[model samples]
Target: MSDSHPKVLLTGATGFVGGRLLPALLEAGLSTRCLVRSAERFRKPGTGGPGFETVEGDLLDPGSLARALEGMDAAFYLVHSMGGRSISRYRDYIDRDIRAAENFVRAADAAGVKRIIYLGGLGETGDNLSDHLSSRQMVGEILQSGRVQTTALRAANIIGAGGAPFEMLRYLVERIPLMVCPRWIDTKCQPIAIQNVIEYLLGCLLQPAAAGLTLDIGGPDIITYRDLMLIYARARGLKRVIVTVPVLTPKLSSYWINLITPVPAGVVMPLVEGLKNEVICKDNRILDLVPIRLIPMEEAVCMALAEISEGPGRIPSMQSCLIRDV
Candidate 1:
């Protein structure tokens, strides 16, 4: 690593995507710092060594965010309140998200952070947008409205081991020979592998084309939720049948998922409801900018499964996977 690398701050360093992203940033030779609510939770042995630091901070606490953003060239915003205490209703989550995003925007602006890179949910803006997806988009908009340049990457159904959505799909396919799915299963999505997602994030760091851009990122495959489950079954060499019924409401579907998979209803509801809207990528601008060999749906499934069986905290091999112009 060079001595003059850009200093970067990463929020949500303990979360699934952020956890993976922390190391990827380090591997890319950036001087990385993580803003975590609790330092102990993130400071495990053999991690955050030279060129990395962990700062105790909270997005809701502007003072902490200001301190964390000090002298940082860029920051990755990956924080969300999906299953917090005030989340009885979906709007509650939205309100909390808005509050946190506003605080981040103000603090980052005050500290003169150069750019804000955010990962938000994928969905078209419309009346039918679920509260979950709407909130995610709204956060991106709030970050973009700030003084700093913002690169918002909207993604759908990120396929990875131990990810909430992938775990839901994996457990459902593994445990059930036949599935009773809601109409949302037929809704189309472009699922990306976790490896590809990290690649895009790393590529955006110094890529001028990604600045001030709201890009949609995903794998090469456009698949439905039903197709995703079936693909997992095929990849795992399991036979399964999916029966899509229109009568199941999002509430009912969440409960169904809760009963079948280890994912709780609280976490499952928003994801299930969001599925009612198709989340396939409409823009391929990221392909031209990042230029990664997009993984296929089945191959992503296999990679995710391999990670799951191999245990946690391991990213797929990157020896031949990465090709960056920077």
Candidate 2:
């Protein structure tokens, strides 16, 4: 670690979590460079944020990645492929995600980047793991396999405005009075608020104890997906009738969700499958390393609703057109 402020690189800076994290890094007085395919999307020509700059790069492009990573102390790997626009494109997400991770690892190692912090999906690892969960875990493993000190923070269903899960719940609950859901609604999940997620991420950057560790971070409440929807319904002051049917498979659920919510069937595939497993935190080491009062699920939903009052979700036009991995 450097004695002075560390220079960090942020990937997926325009996505849900990355967008929120960039400003936080800048506010903390760290020189943060965002890696983007198009720099113009991050800032207008000849204008930039204090302590922040955008580098034209892609994880899949090794030459560009090396340039973006050069002289960086640490980096955040927040990039994720949301299946794709159509079913055919969705088929290659696992391979695409893996290749990108491999490219990143090689680039970071060659660049001599000391630390890599990654936000990965939370789920049990085994033969039963969903394609989404397995791919996420594989990406984390890929980052850790490199020479750098990697901190992998696994989280389930991050609840906040503009997030895919929140957006799905927002549209589904707001639109349908009678919601028909699969039986997996009873699956337990420990979801953290976006603010808490950012704090934990910053903690991993500042505190060396978090390096080379895989940790789980979640909220104070460990509840079922059904409870999550009820909480949202209650917060919105709307009464929803949730019907759970055993016959509905994950594929069917995804399609139904796609039909009703902004989240597309492709995006919902992994999400609904992820819900089939219990995603509650297995340990709280991250809290011990970087302590904060975890927000309650009800409060988290209320806060998300407050942002909705500000207007529609702030996803880019393309991202909004389909459901995304939260």
Candidate 3:
């Protein structure tokens, strides 16, 4: 609202999206503070450069949240409880996420935080949604219902190195020559690049018109899980045969993914459950408000591969990958 840059407080600074978003936020010249569980864990000697600092806190603690949000112009609600390594503990993720969001809403509202930006899943809201996707949407609702202005950016599977969806796809195609898939393989989803997601999040903060709105963000291509598998296969110069089986439920599919990928079953199960439902963007208003060059699936997969690859095996880009043809 003023000529001076707003002070921003970022939660989940050590998370998948937050980890990446932190650098982008600092580089864009905002005075940034990270609300991390441990300052020592999220900070380094020169990590975030100028106008960056860290505050130790937890979302579940209202006092800590108050301390973190005080004097901050904007904050990001990026915390999610689904990434734990213990499979047995995943059952509590939904409840914990709900509580955390409630705390954040109250704390932010009381502290007079000007705006909040939440990154949520891109699934249709209804009674039949998976627990993971529903929890994400519920958190958005919790934040939006508060007195503080909130911008919710919903996106489907984000393609990037070390991300759950990308890791599952990468390891699956790299290891499995013949995959026994379920009916959800054909489910439609609009995937977005991690970089694109970062840009949209940054754009929302700068564009005040984005306040108190829910926006769908996705890449240029909308494809099925089967199409993504095929694209990953092509990118790596490998041949894969996927045979669909109607009876292989989400549990079975998650088990299969757990055995194949480095990602834990705790994380894969909820994501696998979400695959049964279509997750394409409902609208593209964000494209007009925060215009960005969307990265297609082909290029996104290649970019992910390049990140995890070593010196001799890197696929520089989609067009330059020698095996992208077949």
Most lDDT-accurate candidate: 3
Instruction: Choose 1 or 3, whichever is better by lDDT.
Output: 3
lDDT per residue (tens digit) for residues 57-137 in model 3:
988787888888889999988888776567667778898889899999999889999899999998887837898998899
Clashes of 2: 1
Q: Give the TM-score of candidate 2.
A: 0.93
| Candidate 3: worst-modelled 10 consecutive residues by lDDT | 317-326
* Cα lDDT of model 2 by residue, 1-326, tens digit: 65347899999887778877877788788888989888766632122367777789988778889889998999999998775447445546788889999999999999999999999988888748788888999999999999999999999999988788888887888888997788888888898998899899998899988889999999999899889989999997999999988999987777777777766556766677677878878877987899888999999888877765655444332243333332
| Candidate 2 residue pairs that clash | 264-323
**lDDT measured at residue 90 in model 1 versus the true structure, 0 to 100:** 45
- How many angstroms is residue 305 displaced in model 3 relative to the true structure, after the best TM-score fit? 1.4
Please give the lDDT score at residue 54 for candidate 2: 77
Clashes counted in candidate 1 amount to 0
Candidate 2 local lDDT, residue 103: 97
User: Whose lDDT is higher: candidate 1's or candidate 2's?
Assistant: 2
Query: How many backbone clashes are present in model 3?
Result: 0
TM-score of each: 0.92, 0.93, 0.92
